[model samples]
Target chain A: MVSLKQLDLTDLSVRQVNEYLHGELLEERPAGVEILNPDGLHSIAAGLDTEVEIDILGHAGYFIAGMNQRARVTIHGNVGWSVAENMMSGVVRVKGHASECAGASGHGGLLVIEGDASSRCGISLKGTEIVVGGSVGHFSAFMAQAGTLVVCGDAGPNLGDSLYEATIYVRGSIHSFGADAQEEEMQADDFEKVAELLSRAEMNYDAREFKRVSSARSLYHWNADAHQEY
Target chain B: MCGIVGLLARRSDYRDDLGKLVTPMLDCMATRGPDSAGLALFRSPLETTSRRFALYAANIEYDWQSLADRCQRELDTQASLTFVENHAALVSPVAVNTFKAWLKKTAPEVHLLSVGQSIEIYKDEGHPEEIARRFHFSEMAGTHAVGHTRMATESAVSPAHAHPFTAGEDFCLVHNGSLSNPYSVRRKLESLGIAFETDNDTEAGCRFLEWRMREGDTLETAIEVAQAELDGFYTFLMATADKMVLVRDAFACKPAVVAETDDYVAVSSEFRSLAHLPDIKHAHVYEPAPEQIYSWSV
Candidate 1:
């Protein structure tokens, strides 16, 4: 039998709920937790380190499920900025659209946005697999050092700017690429990676239809004639 | 970070509830901005021969009836005043120039907020909820409204520095970010014989656009020109008597979320501020892309 705990934001403040999620819940380890009346407030289920299945019922504000570890969190409505930022491990899924910087700077995790993500999505991504069912806005994957970002829809301008190690697969049109980020021929591994992420996100797109983007490695070298070099 | 909001009612029934609808939107954005708040509401137009002027005075006990009498006695202009606290809405058949001159010579301390057939402006330095309550913002009925809650980054915290800054007749703009070259914009406009009321950065942008419109550019063209001339981060929500225009800068660092439905179009700096609108869950909510023009009719 699964024991479920529902926390109403109107009845309990976000801090008290977070303290509950952070402390006693770890010992009880309830199988499921539901957060009601998000009401576009900030930091609803942020900084969780649990294995419980958490669900958010309404629209949430900034940093909805940031810094997650081992929790399967789902937001049923749209989320504000930087959902699931800096996650070491977990599955954070937003059923609706996301604002800016979704899954930003996550060292590890599978973050999925079912709707369009705004500018700078996955910015500074260290190692997070982000599968977006819809389009992504400008400067997505900026300075991403590791991980894979799969965009099933169009990518906005400056996609994968200053990228490092991380790979991007966009199924639709790319407005433009940023400095040092370039579209490379998709290898077999790229197709496999996209296929795996799409299946995990429960999206239905042909992995072969995707294009890959990665760093050019031009800015990594030090030239004597370039003057200010280390 | 300041917050900006605008609502245009396409449905006739919604017009009567515009204030009741938008008051919570403004008050909800108080988290983003707590220093001051202002609103510009557009009602059904008066006669073409008549005009409306929104007046603001520092003295809460200022005599608006005496000012109307003075307009009759001095400038031979018939004016009616509807007042609450330090703000008053003055409706008259007076020529704007004649009324402005008369005001300058008579009560120099009173600030003229806007002039048009439909627009009425109210603003003050305080929390948005208090400002709304003081002016009875929830009781106002209008076709559309533009409002601002100012955190006052680059300017003082006076009521004058608060937003929904007005320019020419029936035009006003609220800003959510700072400009980098306001002094230069001010210098150029001053050379063109345009005067400014405050050193606020948003005032510079407002006057520049108004001056361009006066020089025969359409609002769209003036905004296009402003995109090049004005440099900085901004999500500008502008309104005329008939139109509400929203635009973000090239970088678009300042946030703007727009929700449009069959009944109305709403714009705000954040979705939290817009979450209270009727049937907002069904509205087409989306972030405005960078450097794009979105205009809606009242």
Candidate 2:
């Protein structure tokens, strides 16, 4: 049986909570942790290196669980901007909507948003797999280098602008696709991959409705012949 | 970067604590904007059928009594004045335009912060908490209020450049994000005889709305027209005597969240700002769609 440690952020300052989470907790390596009454505090549980299970009871502010190496974090309420930003490994889940720049520039991780995410989700994602259950705001996956972004709902405008290499799956309507981003037919392998991602995120959604988007590869090298496309 | 917050109470019981509640919301977004702060409050109109103007002077010790006396003598009507810090609230039975003309001729240096039946605006170049303290915000009681904390990007930092720019009578606007083509817009409006106070981009947007409203367009129509005319990323919170409106650009780059309950409608740049509101845990919170105007009327 795993022991559970409890922490409350009602009175502690954001700096104090971040310091404790990044310093002592990383060294002690608690099996499970619960943060009660988060109340929209910022930078909570950021830069965690331990493989521990953590749960936040209330709303969290910006950069919650950012730069995680190995940690399974679950936020029971909504989150502010840049949740799970630049994660290396492990899973971060939000039961409610997440604000802008969620999972931005993450190299490796699984980010699951149970509700809608605001603008700039999964921007510059590298090897991270993000699953959003609801609609995403504009400028999502802008300049993404690599990885996969799966949206179960509608996607906002300018999706995947200036992409190098990334696989995007959307089950609903897309407002507009960004430059160099084109819709591709979802193959049998693509469906299997999306099914695995949804199963990993613990979300129940029909995989057949998903559409695949990838880079057109037209802007890979500048050519005067393709000037009209540019 | 800038932070904006607006709160309108549907119930009169929450009026007394409006300032106290909104001040904290403004203070929480201090990191987004640290240079200057401003607020516009709408209190219940006085029992008398008089128009009110809130005036601010750079020198805190400027004599406001003489101005009131001048207005009373020249306009042939009773004028009442009340002082709070460097601001004075004056009420007169004269029309707003006539009173404003008289004021411009008499006290050219005294700035009119706002002129309306119930609106009072106070702003200065400083931290939000300092500005709130200087204005004694805790003692104010109102039905609705809007505030802005500005981090100057294109304009110089001063009280005049601070936000909550008045458009017409009781209409004011607070903006986050920059306008791409304000100079061209300013030139067009200037050609139409719309006088401008500051070179700030937000002023151009406000004056555009004022011009549209003057041309018989409703606030909703003006906003829709603005969407087609204005370029750049912006989230605007506008307030009239009876309504509060919120609009975001089509790109939706700048953040805005709204929480509504049976008693109040609250808007802020982030959820952290609205976390402390009464009954927020059960409040219906959602982000407004891009380019869609969300409004509430009293």
Candidate 3:
């Protein structure tokens, strides 16, 4: 297993560090790579395709682990923009707050933000599972495709705008739905699924306390012509 | 700096009259970039091999002939020098590897932009349709093609500064946005004594592709590296002889949409350009993911 010491970044540029993490040291990163100072370095561990594990000690920057194929990245500090953006597969754990577009256009995999998540948290999420422990910013889950987003705290304005096929669950109040999304009663099966996902991420939560939100069956379906006004 | 459009036949499924089908599509992206325009077409009626290269310079200088000559000599085995012009050429029996190796040994400071099969470029400054008329871009045809419209930010306005910038024989690129940091990268490219033709970020992009390909990166990987390292907002498209690659910036500040059918795929800066397709009603249209790459093969 590749065991990168945190001190190894003394001389390497951000690109070099990413190249080493995603390119050369990927296969050997079974034991995981430990980053000492992950302070705002954009594109860290991006596009990784191995089953490697990366531990960032501090805040990270935009598009970190973008297009991730099969890597597990954990951030200890707050992350800037687009954490795990456009992820194809794999897992990303943000211990602190997350900025805008947290999982934008993700096709698959799971994202867990332990703290507050900013606006457009799961914008255009395509088959991704996102769980935010704290509140979220405006337009969260905008234009989401097919996936599941779970927010433990309050959601901001225009939640689930232009939502496609994704499902959302929130323990706190939502300002409003953007287009056709609406709140629904949580079912037994949905509670079970949410509980399982939260358990997998080891988050402290009870699925029973949350309500489910989803499309009103109005937009994007082949024959559904009824449009919902903002 | 430019807009690029192309047709990549899933199974050579584009219309029999490919040229006739491509002209109007290329004409749509005029506002994005409009400095100068050109088109390169290739066909394999019997057995044809194509190679595409996108080169980036480490630095901007007055001359690139030595680098070009080195490229010509290094890639002699794969290319027969079918045609030569100010920036690029058309070669028969395009050699992908030979060109790649030459890039590594010679233009290590440059970036290898792209590598693939058949390439056609339509570039100029003006509205897309206006540039098309000026270049007579409709005359060229291929199963796969890429076009660019320029809104110059860093480079001087000229055909040389235009998009669909070529690296070797068959690769070209069209870009939008600026590279925030060009000094260090340009210095490195010039360290190899590589000369540059234009003062545009797009040229730097071409050099970067060349540099990456030389480093043994696939055209796709090279372009990805460019997207990662280069700074600022970028929503650009690239075409090689064999494939088309698109990259959006970190936040995807710019807009790009992709419409795909079983038989066709179209990309544009806005959705309106795609609304004109015959199968537009049936195709699935979506915006490309930010900081992502979408590829199509010819």
Docking class of 3: incorrect
**Mind giving the per-residue lDDT tens digits that candidate 2 earns over A11-96?**
77767766767777766766788898787778888988878899999888889999988899999989988999999999999999
lDDT of 3 by residue, B162-269 (tens): 666666546666666777776666777878765566677666777778778878999878877877678777777776656777887765666566668887777766
Could you tell me how far off, in angstroms, the CA of residue A11 lies in candidate 3 after the best superposition?
64
Better of 1 and 3 by lDDT: 1
- Model 1, B1-298: lDDT tens per residue? 9989999999998899999999999999998899999999999999667889999999999999999888877877677879998999888998899899889988999999999988999999999999999999999899999999989888899999998999989899999999999999999999988988999999999999999999999888999999999999999999998899999998889988889999999998888888888898889988899999998987
Q: Which stretches of candidate 2 lie over 4 Å from their true place?
A: A225-230, B46-49
Candidate ordering by lDDT (highest first): 1, 2, 3
Off by over 4 Å in 3: A1-230, B11-15, B34-42, B45-117, B120-122
Lowest summed lDDT over 10 consecutive residues: which window, candidate 1 chain B? B72-81
DockQ-superior candidate, 1 or 3: 1
Instruction: Identify the candidate with maximal lDDT.
Output: 1
Task: Give the TM-score (0 to 1) of chain B in model 1.
Answer: 0.99
List DockQ for all candidates. Answer: 0.70, 0.66, 0.02
lDDT of each: 0.92, 0.89, 0.69
| Model 2: lDDT of residue B71 | 88
With candidate 1 superimposed using the best TM-score fit, by how many Å does residue B190's alpha carbon deviate from the native?
A: 1.3
TM-score, structure 3 vs. true = 0.48
